[model samples]
Target chain A: MKTIESRSNPLYKQLFKWQSSAGRRDEPILLEGVHLCEAFLALGRQPQYALFDQTRITEPHLAGLIENLSEEVCCLLPAGLLANLSNVDTGQGVLFVVRPAVATLPTHLNANMLWLDRVQDPGNVGTLLRTAAAAGITRVLASTGTASLWSPKVLRSGQGVHFGMHLHEHIDLLAVARTLVVPLIVTTLSEANDLFEVELPVQAAWVFGHEGQGVSQSLIDLAALRIRIDHAQAVDSLNVTAAAAICLFEQRRQHR
Target chain B: MKTIESRSNPLYKQLFKWQSSAGRRDEPILLEGVHLCEAFLALGRQPQYALFDQTRITEPHLAGLIENLSEEVCCLLPAGLLANLSNVDTGQGVLFVVRPAVATLPTHLNANMLWLDRVQDPGNVGTLLRTAAAAGITRVLASTGTASLWSPKVLRSGQGVHFGMHLHEHIDLLAVARTLVVPLIVTTLSEANDLFEVELPVQAAWVFGHEGQGVSQSLIDLAALRIRIDHAQAVDSLNVTAAAAICLFEQRRQHR
Candidate 1:
């Protein structure tokens, strides 16, 4: 029956710290809204701490969630408190602080994966995670220049499916490149085969680069194949998110 | 040699009107930033009116563009004025009011097309247009509930490629469904075949739906085929933009 009323409370201050991208730790990140809570529960993981909106207790779905948590791990708070913690206007009414299980990338890359280099937009980064997971990508590596992988915006955009992913951020693309054994594909505008005409490897990595620049030269040098989406000659290029989805699913299409 | 400092100046007011979606006409929409200006010039289209940032005059690229404009069609404005006209923080220091050629969607719906039924996110709508144009889809028809095709946000996300596509907004889905001459594909979560397993038509229309709901029931009833991307069974769905890209490119892959 403990309740948190003041923003200055020790627990509130700590949760606030975790909410920021810079304050995040390597093990766990803040999980916002009901969808993420469900994702954690579906995966048999418990939130270290849970906050509930007094007003939403009547919601059967949320109510069922509250019933399952131990008394020591959950608390009821003002709806306004929970609402302010989120970036979106209508924040989903629950919040959880959960530690994710550790994921280790193979020393040598072999499976279908996505290597994101300096893909800074949070929405694009999040959508890429969702799409990569949907395309059954085995892993996703975000170089140091990429958006903060565990930031709230990235989590919200991911719609709570990060649990199923072997997502590693702040890694070095050059280090990964040295160990990659499969066909390494990087998209470029020149000396490229039309994406449709090129048969994709059954298990290979698709590296998508920054919004302004194509793949970094260091990684581009490692690419066994450089392909381009055959677009209208008048248009410059596709959005990074669109390009990633088309590339990943094309590979998935070939294998399936 | 005249400058407009007053917001009430007739031309300034008119340009402001075009900045909004509701005030849009059947004529050309405004293109903001340097990238869009380059796109228009690259296509060899003359701007009806152009505005330059006084601060950016020394930039070599802008100087080249200004040199190309006819004296009657272009003017220089304070950097502040040009920057305020855009939604992005760095407004790229150039703007154009170019009249694009008119395009029509056939009543018969024979060609490859994208029928968007209430796909409301502006970014999603803009990305869809970019993808459809890249896939070489002939026309895009947006339902009445869809995002305003000419809104400032859409225009910015669209990156001026809107100029190359036949984009129509606030259209009826039923009328379009009735006129179908090819397989009308709708994406849904249930009783749908795996997207990859099904061979997509070389030339056919794909109808994408809203963010929350799938395609309208009325339109879904008219669909000759319902296809879904095969993903991990636990996750809810892929973002609508990702779904559209995967489906369109799969068809593109088959034909190529």
Candidate 2:
């Protein structure tokens, strides 16, 4: 295994750039910490590189896991360099770089697709992906304004669930909505029809709008049905990610 | 307004410590950026102190908002000092400190309540608060292992929903569960009954467990009903926050 010590090292610089700009630029993501690395390995995805700090590699599980990886997969960095290379508070002495899996939209349309419009938070994007996957919605079309589906934060938030879905990014949601064969279900606070009261089509596209502004008027007009989660009078609405989960789960329930 | 120019300034140092350690320690919390400041003001919550970078106060809305605040509400700081004070990138040139709100649980229990167990992420905890408010669940109880509901991260993530609900933290969940006059509904992937299949009680306590772990075994054993959201075979389960939203919405549907 090769040792990289300098903060000025080209590889270290590349890792930092990748970490900060993974969303804006279409580059391979850097996954930090032991838990994510273990999950990656468990899924049989070979990492391009695995960097570990020598000082913290005392635990048997950590040591054995590093030892078991192919010799070419390992690289040891000085503690300072490893710290500089990771984003999290506790680096867990390990990090890896893997090519982000290309996310594609499913060729065939399903009624249970999720259309994300300008949902910017990476954690929310990731949670929505996990929710969509759980609701058995295989396809997610992320409008250009939405966070990158493959960004490290989203990936970590998704907790490896991205591997199970068809996630398309930088999509024009209006265009997709126009082409869909199924009814478009858009969630809005202003809508009077409670999601439960409305007979959701077994096949429908669930569209979630921006966090603050919500779904655009154009998208709302495009939607065949505008549904709202019934709530008490005190609060306005659920978070977009949470709203997506509720809507998708309810849709799944109807199909079931 | 007074000017705080040095990192060594006692108040500045105290603010920095509060920003970084507020979550871990039960002390003052740091609130940064214009949005949260606006939220705090809208909620009629006063800040202990606010620090502003004159250079970054370019937006009229921000300036106008600040002008409307009491004369003692803020102090201007050198750009470098303000930069040093923030933890996030693009600090937008302002930060402040506030005492954590003492949110109370309702004295009379409602049919619907939100019970959170061992939820560690501050953002998730905040989102749950927002979701609880949106779902119209007036009462929320966070278990001992849950993140601090009043921490800056949770407050920011909650997007002002904390001001809307009866929120409690560090409560004994089992004792609360045992005392609920309404049915205690626990969400778990391992549960035999799908959420939709069960005739969800109109009035019930909804329990969401930790991020990775579902409801605890003891809580599940004590729950009046255990329910699972039926998902497609391809996905495991929804993110805990998302799951909470779904369950709460389902319960809201029953009453409607």
Candidate 3:
């Protein structure tokens, strides 16, 4: 194993850029911890590079992982240097730089697509992606205000589901809604129609909005149906991530 | 405005302890950011104390919040001191110390209670609480392995739902389930009954498990019904938070 100790080392600088950059402009996204690295390997996707501290090389599971990697794909850095590259305070001592998947909007429409409008929280965005994948959704359209799908926080929250779906970022949500032939259902707290009472479309696009605001007026007006999950008197709204899961699951249940 | 500059100040130490000690011992939960603090006030609960960065006291919305606070409840800290007390890297420039509500198990619960088994993630635990409240579920019993309900992370995830419910953390789930007169419905991946097909009980306790391990054997054996949310081919399981919302909503739909 080769170890680079200097924080100013070119490799360390690249790792820093990978963690902090908004988009994959010049650097690949960084996947930290062994769980994600194993997920990458299981998918047969070669990471651009793997960096680990020398101490981690002694652990059985990590050592096995390192031995399984192709020589060209592995690199070692000092513990302090690796820590500096981690977004979380406590780094598990392994980080992988992987090329972000080339995501696009689906050309052929399916009845089930998730539209996220200005959903700002990274954890919420990531949880939505996981829910979408669980409900067998294949494509997601994220508007300008939505969190970057490839950011480290979002990637970690998604837990490798990012590699499973088609994710198009910074899209014109209203334009995409207008182009779709399938029924577009938007979730809203103001809607009088309860989700369970409304007949879900066989093939439809589901749109979810920001945490505080429901779907934007432009998108809400474009919707074929406005649905709400009936709630008790105490709560104002469900957490956005929780709402996404419920909406997607309801649609899947109806289609079944 | 009152300014406290010393990091060694007792107020600073207490805030730091509340922020860092999620796993160790029980303490008053810390609520960060202005939005949550505002929500707390709207609910008619007074904070033990509030710390604000002196510079941020000038921002209009924040200034309004400060104005609303009773004079004795507000304490202004130096910008740098406020930065040190904050858990999030970009602090919303306000923090509140509030006593977490003490939650109790319902002795004569007639269904409509939630039993969580070893849900390790604080965010999931919090989201479950919020969903539980929205579904009109007043009682939640968390097994010993479940994340602490009063943890700063869970409290933040619950988004103030803790105050609205009867929450019992660190309990023997199987023993409690055995004592209940209502049917125990446990959610599992291997269940024969699809959640939508089952006649959901209006007054039954719904039990959910960890993300990785389905409900434990003891709890499984205690359950009168085991149910699953059917998904399309290739998808395995839904995230626990999403699963909780769907299950809760389904039960609510059946009763309504």
Which digits, one per residue and each the tens of the lDDT, describe model 1 over residues A48-110?
A: 888888778779878878877777888778888777666668866778877755577778777
- Answer with 1 or 3, whichever has the higher DockQ: 1
Write candidate 2's Cα lDDT for B153-212 as tens digits. 788788766665677788888887776788888887674587777788888888888877
Model 2: CA > 4 A from native: A1-111, A190-192, B1-28, B43-60, B63-85, B92-97, B103-111
Candidate 2: DockQ?
Answer: 0.63
Segments of candidate 3 deviating more than 4 angstroms = A1-13, A22-26, A52-60, A63-69, A76-81, A89-93, A106-111, B1-98, B103-106, B232-236
- For residues A179-198, what per-residue lDDT tens digits would candidate 2 score against the true structure? 78888888876754777877
Considering chain A alone, report the TM-score of candidate 2 relative to the true chain A.
0.89
Q: By the lDDT metric, which is better: model 1 or model 3?
A: 3
Candidate 1 chain B minimal-lDDT segment of 10 residues: B19-28
lDDT of 3 by residue, B1-256 (tens): 4556798877778777777775444476678787778878877788888888888888986887887788788888888877776667888888887876775566777857888999998988988998988889888888888998877688777877777777787888888787888999888877558899988878888888987897998888878999888865434567788888888887877778
Q: On residues B212-238, what C-alpha lDDT tens digit does candidate 1 reach at each position?
A: 897988877888889988876646899
Ranking by TM-score: 1, 3, 2
Residue A144 error, candidate 2, Å? 2.5
- Give TM-score values for chain A, per-prediction: 0.92, 0.89, 0.93
* Candidate 3 docking quality: incorrect, acceptable, medium or high: medium
The sequence of per-residue lDDT tens digits that candidate 3 reaches over residues A56-94 is: 788876887787788787888878888877888888888
Residues forming the 10-long window of minimal summed lDDT in candidate 2 chain B: B102-111
Q: Residue A214 CA error for candidate 1 (Å)? A: 1.2
Q: Model 2 misses residue B130 by how many Å?
A: 0.2
